[model samples]
Target: MITTAMRTRASIVPLLLALGCPQDGGTASEGGPGTSDGTSAGTDTTVPTTSAGTSSSGPDDPTGDTGDTGDTGEPPGEPSGNDLDQNALFTCRDQPALPPADLRLLDRYEWTRNVGSWLSSDLANNPLYPRPEHRYSTYSDDEALDPSVLGLYLDSVGGAADSWTIGKWDGGRLRTVHEDPECQCFLYDAAPTSECVRYFVRRYLEFGALFRPASEAQFDALLAFTEGVLAGAPDVESRPAVIKRLGAAAWMSTGALHRPELGAGEPDEHGRLQLGDWELANAIAYALTRTPAGVPSVNRSYNAGFSKGDVDGDLGSILDAARDGTIKDPEVVAKLVEEHIGGIDEARLDLLFEPHDERYWETHSEYWMAHGVREFFREWLDYGELAAQTPKVEVAATSAWSGYAVENSYQNQIVGFYGYESTLDYQLDDMIARILDTDQDVFANLLTSRMFYTPATAGYQENETSIWKSTAEANRVYNVSGITPQTREGRWIELPQNERAGVLTHPAWLGAHALSFENDPNLVHRGKWIREELLCQNVPDLPITVDAKLSEASKSQSARQRMSEQIDADPYCAGCHALMNPLGYPFEIYNHAGFVRVEDHGGPPDGTSNLVGMPSPELDGPVTSAIDFSQRLANSRYAKRCFMRQTFRYFAGREETMHDACTMVAIEKAYDDSGGSFTEMLIALFNSDSFQTRVPD
Candidate 1:
């Protein structure tokens, strides 16, 4: 029976045909001679000619003979046959148990951001973007692009082609950095001839794939596929329009979609696979910034002079460094990091928060975080979830007036009686920004720093003061004592030391870790976060037969009192809960809404818990409250090492094997040497063998 799926597959047959791949025993009308596996027979994708006197096919290949050349008077540069790697490009190739090369697919965010930067349009809301299914990081190298996902990719690119116009093409893109006359036709509005198409396709591969030279086979297949597209297009469409469509097709190819961390050439004597110039450039840029090396962005505004003018967003200098091999130096990499890693100036930060300007691609939320430094903390701390799924917050009038001195009458009335969980994401972001600008003890500061941005102080840089004030007042749960609507000077303020410590103690983090839509603390989840993320310890999953539900909350007992009876009483539950509950119970000083609780149910809340079996003996005993816990965690070497590991996982897009131990040790030393500067650790990490080299299977 004919199905919708069948019809969808049938519709794109022509475009696939244009790719010059044919099924086994396929007819010539399908685009080319068919191999048994439906792949091209050779490695060259350039169209070949039947000229008998043709001496050689270029430097990579020295064979004087051309294959099965028919005297069609075609161009002499084309290779013998359609030579694309069908398995790698068209299907999910079987990965080796330990693959020789490290190839990570560009996550949906990276793809959307890159495409948006290239096109200079906002594509963040594009429905075609496939979000990462993982619970933590947005990217995962372990995931593969299967057949179903490939179909989505094909549809996405095809849709992009349909919507694209000639005017949208950025003609000036990569032109200054790439001065090759033959390759200048990339997204050009002018009509390119048959001969110019090959050069155009090659350039597309090079730029789209982040300067990695396309293989001869890939070049030949793409060239023929592009020609087929042009020849077969309806006369209703203009040549430039057709070329744009073809450009979209090439943009979504395997070479463009997946980033190659395979490094250059073969393994060395020590079995190290050092990244090539282009590969290294791409790795550095992606690790620090969301975009590739040569893309125009404020992050790449380095002082290195290039023939192309050194504009704010111009990254031509980086491309030049890669080409000249200066980027291979560790000092150069460190310099680039130092130059790019910084906070936005007040003027620009104000502008970013202002109404959107059509001239810029960056948004208020994204502009200030160009280097993704803030984002790293956001994910690592996992606090952003509060904004996504806010839990209910209710603050009484007496508490609001006495605790935060609710001065605003409207706020007092609204907040004193009732409140909802206001998203404190912006507040946390601002706090991180302030600390990063200081650029000292990044990890330590994140854990134990009392300085923060309340709504009253949010507007000076990010222009979020008034909004934050209203929200905080409405929530009536402002735990910080000095912050009020009237204190709107827009400066960072320190909370009372006894009340708060670090990001974990922040209201946002507390609210995010709370049980969904409840005023109750999520004991297991909070404990698990500490166990896995901070301590680098793993908790066993609950057995299938176990009913993990806790007894209902009541006015008779406190949260800790109620939870302990169920979790600690059971032998099996206690076995795992012992690792997590003690770590989590310290946070009970604050309610689910992040309000400092004077009383829970009927009595003073017990926030005390014992930390046992910790890798660091100093951190093994203890714990009075969240503040005390934060102080201990801030000083723990074990915690810092775990943070470094998390950082490695985040940037490398995968879990570290034993091979990464040296890198970890080096990063630790660098962190200590720089007095715990996160930036210095990153520099050390980027230059480390684990980051720069790969292992061959």
Candidate 2:
């Protein structure tokens, strides 16, 4: 009697279990964290109790202040971050079913970024590099680790560690540890004093590797491991080799490899578990900085002359607060969030178009916003896929029709060295960065902004040059029309509002969501993205018995006409197509190449479509074109809430449920309070219960 959805859910549990994460009552076994080597750390296995004087009182008496805790009572403490007064403004009618705590594995993008920044190596490009889980959102945790991935992690950790070197900037150049008085012990001393080893372990292992205050047992184990490496060496020359091996083991340890969110103490009276100080620190760090601590070396060209805020000092404050448990204050967290995201310069947007090469980090030390923020837009819009997969073949220029030449000419437009698809990707990224830089009405602007980034807006970076000698010479005819020469010098041109609306009408997005090589439109998938992603609604998968193929193309009829005759008329397919096709048909104004179509298959293309039976009654209406539809979507309150829902999924690393009602409501309020600023929404999310609290299995 199990339904298909139930069976699918059941299948994922085995996949999670196979990954070696413990699922027994939401606790880590003896083999967890400190004892990855199977050597018992001899630390207390029992959950730690709250240091604060709060006891397991009545359901609403956990904090003795019902207003502070909202519907789900607060954990034992002097009000953790989630207990802010604003949380009580709206209440959760449903029971709190916060996501259970587990070890969140870093995604593939993070691993690659870490390998480059921390190890200073391109080893992530190797075929041997471990492949993590694949998911739409960058923040989704990997549930299973393949055997091959484990083996690769074991084999590659040592070499990756060896490639890294601790250095300082001196006179605008990098100085090795050999020249540093304190760091020199690591390079030359074979039989270093105990004091030397402790400093090394604290500096590299605690902050650099484990990303938290190492447990006493962990510290002793690593200290012993470091001494053993030095003592077992054959010569004084071997001292240098010891550091890499020591670093490798630290990097390989589970404490460094996975982020543990199991709350330090027992579950509260409401079964709500609270994250420990160190765990919360890391949670905020990953949410904001995408690292355990700041690594200025991530930007290889960092000089002492740079005017950005003190990286070490800023991270030191966060760590100090974690150790003192002052990070539990929502006010403290809100201030930290402001410091991280506020006052971002628009110039940083140039980095988005920069290829993520070694030079990319050299020229730009910090991103415009958090890397996670940038990734959310890329993943949400699904435009990042265009750069990786540009399977659309260039249409051949033929004398048969002038429109064919227009579609074919785009491939020849030189925008640096990128392919036509990649150019579009970069262009869309540019538009997104501009919107984000404003930090006002972000979701609405993203949907309705007429400003567009063309090739002329490529900025003054050394590797980038404006490819357009003239508007006619550029690829604007079919690719992106109405771009002016004034778009140069980092200026974005306002495209005709009638021709374009938001990013959905952008050539890159339109083309990315279109058919491979055919001149016909890709209806279902485009509609599917809009239906599920924007509306936060689900459409069931097509049954395996259904062939799902569209009717063959005909020069006599428009693509929409053919689809209407076949898909709309068929009762079996009409059910789902009704949900999607109406949403997609409006986009038929643009062809597969993303060119505005005047004629389709010798006839005028029908771009009229309507939304019916949607979650928002405001959105369910007739539309003349994609532009009008996009404007409607931008203005709809339901669509804006859906954007917040999507943002929660990216940050929380899971889908939002009824259990997360309180968090979602708070986030929406924060968005409204800040005039729809993404920065404020992130602050509200970081302070939400679902982010700071856990649920024990």
Candidate 3:
């Protein structure tokens, strides 16, 4: 069940699914699957409440009033700067963003589907008739349950099952379903034609279906299981009957076991009671009579008796009892589920339906302690007494830190580094704690400046020529400029210190260089990043126009060249690319690998690469190292402002406008005054209004 691909694509599937698929209703609607109606399911009859407040607006609420706490600031009025609208930046609306309860329901549905698929597949050669899809509503009935859909559902369920298996199942094979005509309808024979098939089908029905349903008595039994499991109780005699009933149903459903006649004297080695055919025939009848709560109590009693004196057996029996009933108590089933399941829903699901994952708690705690940089700014903006509470502040600080860690550890690793494994634990922790514990004003001041990127060669090799390498060595020099030799021993050393001042002064241009190398099939992304991040320009999309020739002409050229030619062909493209293409052109010297290269298998160093056919300034730069490139970039005023804009956007999670000129000026001044220390810029942005207030659209 465990596969190598699962480990790598764990995050990818969910993200892609969230983005690609519409919500449960199959339209661009809010409140999709996994989102709760806010109140407890048992207490309130009202519709589920989402964190996204009461807005009946369609999913693409340009105003961004979808009720989520996070702000997606889209400035008002016609777009002006660089001809790009501020509204174009938000992408959060394109995803599922489900709540906890709904997520659990989705998990349950997927799990059931997975078990069903496995059963169907295993019995494919069997003569049993295939069941038709349940027709509940016209819409539901119309949606065909195709193999692909079933496969996706199965995959999700399998993931959850795998997660459960992690600490509990111990490599037990999943139960498989088969057909047998001799067994009564829904009666399973304990001794089947195939042991593997019998065991799998029995386990699947018990765990995947009967036990997961929500009913009154099942809920009670779930609570009981939770209490017993947490206490490590050895006796589970209270829930055995439920387990037996569950096993019986599963056995019957698969036709692997016949309904047994019950006149049981004692249980067998596997804790199953010996029964006559008549007893097995009456199993479902007995099960139907008991309410959900009644089953758990019966199961508990059966488990206690079955385990007798063995602690491990007692625990296993208790779990089996819980699994047999309709109790959804995660705590009782935590060990079982964890041992049997396979997915990332461990913590998120636990938060909704069970106890939270201990690993998540630990990771979250560490994350909070590591990233407190923005908290100080929030406090300074609020000017509240709560700011004095460093511990709480530190906790609040972890959100950003954890976000960065995940972004760096997962997203950046996959996209930016092309799956390179980067060590983030130590750096994230140290940076977060230090940022939080430091004086608020230090950070406040740091944000007021436009210094966001910290240049450090900390992880780079000594001989590396990347900007990170130079910055690391330079940071040490900046830290110990005039300090005594003895005192400086413990301090960080800086190299190329003067040359590498702030993000702009460092080899921040490497990002553009990196983009250039990708030769991305889509030039828009490459051009946009170059325009927005390098030249401080924003290229908003033009109105839909049927330009067949443009598309046709682009087929023959590389993305970069096509874009260059397009800019020349259109006045619209020309105006923007004039500010974008030149800045991005210098980066062409570096390949997608971010390595220096002389030729790109095309002619080299054409001086006539005009932006708008005006014979633009030549970007015939030599490729030696990222540091040399960084120094060359440092001369451009556009680079400086671009860094400032990027820092503001990153801190605010939105774009900057002319209205933010005051904050930008202050930040620029701070950066100039602080010798371009990265910390200075961060402080400046954090203290600004852009960081403090949630702007209205």
Q: Root-mean-square deviation of each candidate, in angstroms?
A: 13.1, 10.7, 21.4
- Give the candidate number with the greatest TM-score: 2
- lDDT tens string, model 1, 267-305? 766665677666677777777765566542221112221
Candidate 3 Cα misplacement greater than 4 A, ranges? 1-527, 540-579, 591-595, 600-633, 657-661, 693-697
Please report, in order, the local distance difference test score of every candidate based on alpha carbons. Answer: 0.53, 0.56, 0.29
Per-model TM against the reference: 0.72, 0.76, 0.33
Scanning candidate 3 in windows of ten residues, the lowest lDDT window is 97-106
- Candidate structures ordered by TM-score, highest first: 2, 1, 3
* lDDT, residue 632, model 2: 87
Q: How badly does each model clash, as a count of residue pairs?
A: 8, 0, 105
Model 1: lDDT of residue 628: 91
lDDT tens string, model 2, 284-349? 867665654432223334443332223232245565556567778888887777666534443453
Number of the predicted model whose lDDT against the real structure is largest: 2
